[model samples]
Every structure is written in C-alpha cells, then in structure tokens.
Target: MKFDFHSHILPGIDDGAKDIEESVKLLDDMAADGVDLVVATPHFYCMNMRIDRYLRHRNAAYEKLRPYLKPEHPRIILGGEILFDHSLVGNDKLPYLTMQNTDFLLLEMPYAKLDDQIIRGVEAIVEDRQVKVIIAHIERYLAFTSYKSLCELMNLDVLGQINAESLAHFGTRRNCFKLIEDGYVHIMGTDMHRIERGYASLGKGMDIIRKKFGNDILEEFERNGKMVLKNYSYEQIVG
Candidate 1:
C-alpha cells in the first residue's frame, strides 16, 4: 500500500519521462524505493490542454508501456497532476480525471497567489462534485502565502499532499515537520519527472524520511494512501 500518488512517468506526454527507457528507469527507481503502487500523473493545465487530446496522448503512452508493466514492478495507476484553474469550478470531467477509479484528484494549485476566489473554487469542486482533492506539492505553494493561510487551506476538507523532495531538498523540512506533527499532511508523493538533471529521487527522499521521521511516519502515510484508494472512511484521516 505504499503508493507514490503523483508522478510524471508517462513518456513524451509532458515534461516527465522523455521516452520509454526513461519511463522504465523511473519505474525501476520506484520499485527499489519500496513503492507498491504509483499514480502516473502527467501535467494537465485545463486552461490550455483539451481533455480529449490529453486522454488520447495519455492512453498512447500507456499502451506503449503496457507490455513492460509487471507485478514485480510498482503497479501504475492513471491520474493527472492538474493545474488549478477557475474553470474547474463546475467541470463534470474533473471526477473522471481522478486517480484510477478513485475519488482522489491530484490538484496542483497556482503558484502565483492564494486568493479567496481560488479557495472557493476548490471548495466548490469538493462540495458540488463530491470529489476528494489532494493538493499536490503543498510545500511548493507555501512560498505564496503565510503560515496562517496554509493552516486555513489545510482546514478545508481536502487532503494536503506534500512532495518527498520538499522533505529534504526544498529547505522546507522544518515547515513540513510542523504540518506533519499537526496532522495536516495526509499523503506524500515523489513528483518525479526524469532521471537526469536530478529530477528522479524517490529512493533518496525515502531514505531521508526513514532517517529523519522513522518508520511510523512512513507507515502512517501508507495507511492514508491506502484508505483513499480503498474508498474507506477518509474523513477520519482528513480531520
């Protein structure tokens, strides 16, 4: 149940894995890192990318890697790291974009500013559509807002997904620890793109977690992920 819930492992669709070789390499890294499942979340900016075209590209890339998919490797689940836009407020297709058939959507919020309208848009998606949202790379958005703003955002019914790299590389571990200790962090993702230029680091990130936060922390993250995937009573964990 150790699921890497956000990644760009699909080849040539987005700025993730360049080719099938890189895709397999990323999968190998996931398997070595003890990830039992991975959600291949290529980037999707609704303002620009059309849904039909995105799906077609995604399926094509997925088909290319189908034969190589094996039980021993971390099983791939389809999802998208969607960049938030105001238009998503009432979009019916939003639910269809969730992780596999689950209700969890990996949402990458805007890095520009955290405004009331954007916050309401997120709430609308959850309340109106009944789709659970996981705010992707929560640490990345912290730079645009204050600690109070972050706490307020977490207070919403959605789950906050922090990037593994943020746990070590982003110089945000101190803040990440605060969020974790306060039960604000509900899940973790690698957000891995490529092997070169230091984008692939699922193994390295987990190593840091084990040394810094111990096994219990890792287990809790796994449990939360499993709960979401299984359609369990996620409210218990979210609160």
Candidate 2:
C-alpha cells in the first residue's frame, strides 16, 4: 500500500491545512497522487501544548473532515508528529501519541545540530517509553547534521521517514538517496502541508525511487508501512 506516512492535513490543529474545506482539498490531492492511506501527523510540541489538549484538538479536527471522506480519497489515520523533548522520556502516555494504537511515533527534531542530547533522548524514548521512533523528514537535517551523526541516531534501532518533498528537490535528492543507500531510511512520506506542493511531489519522489531503486524498494516500504498500520510492534517486525 502507498502510505503518505507524514502529513499535516488535519484541520486547524497545527500549521497544516487551515480548515475542513482545506483538509478535504489536501485529501483529494493525495488521491490524485495515488496515495492509498494517509497518516495525519499534525505538529505536537511538548513546550507549546499539553498532550491531552493536543489530542482533544486533533480528534476534533479529524472529526470535522471525517464526514466528507470519500472512497476515492486516501483513508486517513490518526498520528502525532511530536517535537522531541527529554521530558517525554519515561512518559507512560507516549503510546497515546503513536500512530493510533500502533507502537510507532513520528518524532520531529529541531533544525539545529543532531548531537548527543538529541541522540540520547531518542534512546530514552525507545528504551524508557517503549515506543519505536521514526525520525520525521530525516533528509532535512542534512543541512545541519553531519552524516556520521545521522548514522549514530539510526544505529539506536530507530527507523527513518524521508519526505517525498526532499526527494523531489535536485539539491536534497542526493543526500536523500544516500540515506536510502546506507539503509537508514525505511519509509517515505509527502509531509504534505500546503495544497500547492507535497501532494504531487509525492508521486514524483516515488517515481524517482522506482527508477533508481526499482519495485523491490517500494515493496519494502509498503511492507513496513503495512506492518505499522496493522498495529505491529516495532520489535515484532524488526526484532
């Protein structure tokens, strides 16, 4: 299945789609991109809002678009793109932020250097919180993080999600491919925020993947994504 694993299509919860109408439009565009399923990962920051409040708002926003959902459009899944914070370590409620009932959490890192604190925090989230972390938009961090540092984070038994937008770019594509080649990246997403981009670029990125890597890589992505949607524990699939 073609899963647009990261997106901000939820209405008004974060700086994604603005309202129900906009959310529907984004979904429609996703359908055109041949996306089979979508994980509406609105931004979640520990410092900015309480998890409970964010959950409430996320549900409310999804509910607004639930009625308008059509068969042609990709099915929507609820998930959180949490901004990584050390306070989240050992938090019992971490699973609630995972891909709805799944053990995988999409965690976004800050734009600064990816270093010891960030790496250790990811370790704590996995070892302490007991949730698998999929680093959101792993390609974007190349601007700030050294390649060796990225390998350290990936070595912590966490997965990486590459944004389709990153692959569609000429400059970023090489590093994105390098991540895939090194086996750090395991999944893909549009990270679709606005209607103007991401959606179409998803198709473009996948096309690029197909041409350069072939169908087998796409199958790996689909298999991993399927396991995720079925609520398979990361250990069950990876370990």
Candidate 3:
C-alpha cells in the first residue's frame, strides 16, 4: 500500500485546503496516483492550536469527510504535522493527535536552522521515551546543509520524510540525493495543498526514485510506511 506519511488535507484547520470539496479533489488525485492511505496531518503550530480545540476540529473534519469516503478509495487517517515546541513534549494529550493514536509523531522542525532545543525535543521524544519520531519534510531543515548535524539527527533513530515537491525543485536535488544515499529519508509525502500540484509532485518524486533506486526501494518505502501507520516500532522492523 502507498501510504503518504504527511499531508495537510483537512479543510480550514490549518494552511491546507480551504474546504471539504478541495480536500476531496486532492484525495481523488491521490487515489489516482496509487496512494492507498494518507495521514491527514493538519498543521499544529506552536503559537496557534490548543490541544482540545485541535482535536475537536480534527474529529469534526473527519466526520464531515466520512460519508464521502469509500472503503475502496484511498483511506484518510488522522494525524498532525506538529511544529516542534517544548510545550508539546510534556503534554500527555499530544500523542492522541498522532496517526491512529500511534506513538509515532510527525514533527516539523523550525525552517531556519537546527537549534539546541530542537535536538533536545527530539531526544525527549525518541531517545528518552523511545517514541517513533517521523521528522516531517526534513529536506527543508537548512541544517542539513551541514553534514555533521544531518548525521547527528540520523543517529538518533529519527525517520526523515521528504516532500515530493522539494525533490522536483532546483537546488534541493543534491540534498535530496544525499539524504537518500545516507539512508536518512525513510518516506516521501506529497504535502499537497492545492489540487493541481499535489499528485503531480508526488509522481515526479516517484519517477526520480524509480529511476535512481528501482522498484524494490520504492516497495521498501511503502512497507516501512505501512509499518509506521500500524504503529509498529521501527526497531522491530530494523531488527
């Protein structure tokens, strides 16, 4: 099954699609692209959403989309692309917002650069508690430009998720290749906001993956993603 680990498909919750119709259009495109499952990761910015309010909105959106969802269609799972903040780590209620209530949390690091706090927060979530930390759109982390920090993050058992569009974008090719070569990237997400761009970007990335790594690697990515979606520990799979 092709499972997209990150997306902003929920309407009006964050910076994703504006309404349900747009959300459905994106889902339809995903289905056409052979995406079997998508984790509906609405943004959870630090300064914005409260835990209770976020859940309330997420649940309501899930219900609203249910009748339109077909079992045969690509499945939409619940999750959030949580912006990394110290407050989220200590919050007991935060884990419920993860995909299927899984221990795996899709975290978005700051866009500018890596900092001590980001490292500490990742350590708290993954190393200290042994939770699965899937770093969302890791290609955007400018710190990756420094090989040392990228290596440090890789050593922490954090899985890197690359955005499809980034791979297609100029200047990011080298970084994307390096991540794939270093085995840092574990999954690819469309991160689609607009309908026209979503599936096409994913296709472009998949094409690159296929030409460079072959079908076997793509299958492995899909398998790993399914394991994540099922809440299985990465250690179990790695072992």
Candidate 4:
C-alpha cells in the first residue's frame, strides 16, 4: 500500500489542516499523488493532557471531517504523532493512541538532545507493551544525536520515518538518499499542513527518489507500509 504514515490532516488539530475544507482538499491531493491510505497523525503532547481528553478532542474533529471524505479518497486511519515522554511508558491507555488501534505507535522526539530516560522509555514501550515504534521525521533530530547514538536507536529495532519535506528541503539530497539507502528510513510521509506547502511536494519528493534509485525503492516503501498494516491486524487477532 502507498501509505502516508505521518500527517496532520485532521481539522483544527494541532498545526495541520485548519477546517473540513482544508482536510478534504488535502485528501484530494493525496489521492491524486497515488497515496492509497493516510494515517491521520495529529500531534499529541504527553506533558499535561490526559489521554481521554485528547481522544475526545481528536474524535470530535475526526467525526466532523468523516462526512467530507469520499469513499474513493485514500482511506483514513486513526493515529497520533505522540511527543515522546518518560511518563507515557506502561500507560494502559497508550494503546488507544496507536495506529488503527494497533501496536504501531508514531512516536516523535523533540528537537533537543536525547536523554537516557527517553531511550529507556522507548525500549520499555516495545519490550513491555509489545509496541512497534516508528520515529516520526527522524531527520529533524539528527542534530541532537551523534552517529553512534543514531545507530543505537536503529539497533533497538525501531523504524525511522522521514518526511517528504525533509527529503526535498531540509538536507542535501545525497545525505537523505544515504539514510533511505542505508535502511534508516523505513517509510516516508508528507507531514503536510496546508495546500500551499507540501501538498504538491509529496509527488515531487517521491519522484526524486524514483529518479535517483528506481521503481524498486518506491516499492520497498509500499511493502514496508503494508507490513505495518498487516502487523496491526495480527496484533488484534492474537489479543
């Protein structure tokens, strides 16, 4: 499946799409760009908000946007870009924040330096809770980590997600390609906000990858995305 594993397309939720119209428009662009599914990852901060309260807000926005989505539009899946914090470890309600109510969690780290507690917390979430963590837009956090630290995180068996925007605008093309080629980037997302910025760039960025590598690279992303969905369903069945 051609899946956008990270996105802020939900209306009035965080810094992505503003209203129903924008949400619909973003979905339209996604379909046109050949995206088969969109994981609607609105931002969720673990600092002060209760999980129940956040779900109420997110569900309400999702309900409002639900009516606008066409059947032909890329399928929408419920998830969140959870800003990682130590407090979230072993929280029973954390499962509700996972993708498709499954074990795959879209975890995001802040732009500052990574501390030991955060690393241990992620490990606990995976080992204790049986969750597979996909680090959101990991390229943004490179400055906070040394190459050794990055290798350590990858060694933990966590998947790294890169944004199409980062591939196109953030770093050198060679470095970005190196990340994907070296198996660091398991998936790519537009992380689109509005039509003005990344709506068009998703296709453009994917095209860059295709041109540099080949169709096989794009197919690898499609296969990896399917594994996420498949694993989600498998977790549900075993439970």
- Top TM-score model: 2
Ranking by lDDT: 2, 1, 4, 3
Q: Choose the strongest candidate by lDDT.
A: 2
Instruction: Looking at model 4, report the run of 10 residues with the lowest lDDT sum.
Output: 230-239
State which candidate, 3 or 4, has the greater lDDT. 4
lDDT of 1 by residue, 1-239 (tens): 56788899999999999999888888887887778888999999887788878888898999998887666789889989998898888887778778887888888888876778888888888787557888898877778887777777777788888878887755687777777778778788888898985544555666677787798877888788888888655576654
Residue 227 in model 2: shift from native, Å? 1.1
Write out the backbone clash pairs for model 3. none
- Can you list the residue pairs that collide in candidate 4? none
Deviation from native of the Cα of residue 90 in model 3, angstroms: 2.7
List the candidate 1 regions with Cα displacement exceeding 4 Å.
210-213
lDDT of 1 at 25: 83
lDDT of 2 at 177: 87
Predicted candidate 4 versus true structure: per-residue lDDT over 61-156, tens digit per residue: 999999888887889998899998878888878888888846888999866767667777788887775577888987777768765566666556
Please report how far candidate 3 places residue 166 from its true position, in Å: 1.8
Report the C-alpha lDDT of model 2 over 152-227, residue by residue, as the tens digit: 8888878889988787778899998899888888788988787755464577888898999998888888888888
Ranking by TM-score: 2, 1, 3, 4
The residue pairs in collision within model 2 are none
All-Cα superposition RMSD per candidate: 1.9, 1.4, 2.0, 3.2
Error of 2 at 16 (Å): 0.4
Candidate 2 colliding pairs, count: 0
